[model samples]
Target: MSSQSLEQRLLRAWYGKAAWLWLLRPLSALYCRVAARRRHAYLSGERDQWQPPVPLIVVGNITVGGTGKTPMVLWLIEFLRAQGYRVGVISRGYGAKPPHFPWMVSATDDPAVCGDEPSLLVRRCGVPLVIDPDRPAAARHLLASADVDLIISDDGLQHYALGRTVELVMLDHERGLGNARCLPEGPLREPAERLESVDLVVRNGAPGDSSNGFSMQLLPQTLINLATGERIAAVRWPGPRQVTAMAGIGNPQRFFRTLESLAFTFDTRIFPDHAHYDASILESLPGDRPVLMTEKDAVKCAGLAQVNWWYLSVEAHLSETFEAALLNLLSVPHSEKIEQE
Candidate 1:
């Protein structure tokens, strides 16, 4: 079966009342034991971890799907810069196949070569970014090449080989933890209790209650024409009521819901997370009324987009309390931070 098909089936099994998912619990248990051993190796110094001279922050999720990590990373980049710090970023570059390891990604780099999220990030903020499957190597390359005092790993919560100064975990407030199991049995990458060890837990949408973690909202900013680079306020979108919407992200439904909130009517084309696109694929859509997608998708489609193609841009907004708490945490020395951990 295709990855997309498997993903859909797992999503159904995880979030819905599918009794057969219990069969996979045995495998999940095995997976958890193995993961625990790997983590223990790092913690006990049985395996060496690369400790960077500068502080490194990891923004990631324990959930299997997207939990607004990209937006949170962008927010951190902007926030730290505003505080007069030179910031750099590193990512595992999922699905990226650059010619070499630790490749520096610029705004002009091809998304297909450096991965969609890294390309979108550099394009949006122009921050120094490096991509490699090896997270520590990427961090080292970023520091060697850029004048940065701090680094942010886009998504590497499970990469214990890379020492982190602070860790921020993101979650979809609505979905929460979906069955609260791991891997094929459910949607979590780690156990639910992993949240207790992280420096902060950020919920993507409005918190249902105080126990849900610090609230974060992905505020829509504007819509940009992929082909012409024209911008218009998202709330003031003056387009046809109906359009062809597509999202290849981890949770396409989230994108659809955002469009609905904007009063848009659309027929969606859901693709597997990180699915690549080309002109012929988009050309097959029934009509050309208008095509809208997330800015992350737009990065890959920009070169092949038609005149009517546009993508919505969003900015992450967090509460003042969260900000103050993050700043206070950053003020602590790395050694002391490790001791606390």
Candidate 2:
């Protein structure tokens, strides 16, 4: 068993203690002030810079962590590709074991360098991905290098300096807004009311009581095996076997509950979102048991994983109107901003 108990995990996740972690809101204000000034200068044309060739559609959320942004990003990439649009992606590459600067992510790139999600995107979508601390710089690099028609930011809702044409917000069904307050006070990034202005708001998991956004539900019972490329029925996995399920995602409870609903009796191991695991940890878990995990973790653990490890993949279900709204927004040509001589 890990040092942290299941109770502690719940406390950290939905207990709303982190909602109060924003006790440093004064400090957050200072950070935003500096950020806003830099962005204002750029938007006001006082800062002369070359804009990226194609339009950028930023899919991000205000609340920190676990709003289903990655799945939505992948969904958008697939949707746009099917529409005959060439897309590229840029990310801050959070949770990489070793730090990195703006660089391209290839199928061969290690997850420790490119981060788990970016690596997964490259492997699954086979599209160009840039990992960088400076997102604007990464976007510029993608524009100059890849022959992409559209650029989608994986998660950068607060990065106003990058200049985006469209914004998508994702809300968690279980924790819409803990206490409805800001950091150190609540779980909101800006405010719940901010959703009214975004281009699209996707309620991830189940539909909550929030207004001004589209409802989205994620069905998690689908099991995928990377080892044999075979799809196994999730219903058969539930039983008295000594099974251990591991997840290092924004929301592990969702995974646990989905498995439980399928009647799987197993012990659970939860890690921080994006926690890097070495071979030693995988070797230490009890039993020759079957281990279940998320797709994001599977990509990183592929080589280290044993034959019994399986990953549950989930897809976002959006109303047809949501897709139409997205295409309608893209259909409008980007209005060129006038530059002063």
Score each candidate by Cα lDDT.
Answer: 0.87, 0.74
What tens-digit string does per-residue lDDT give for candidate 2 at 210-314? Answer: 355777776664677657656776766543455788888877777788778777777888777777788876776655778888899888788886767888877
Candidate 1 per-residue C-alpha lDDT over 222-260 given as tens digits, one digit per residue, 9 for 90 to 100: 999988999999999888979888888887788889999
Top TM-score prediction, candidate number: 1
Which 10 consecutive residues of model 2 have the lowest summed lDDT?
A: 332-341
Per-residue error (Å), model 1, residue 148: 0.4
C-alpha TM-scores of all predictions = 0.96, 0.84
- Model 1 residue runs over 4 Å out of place are 1-4
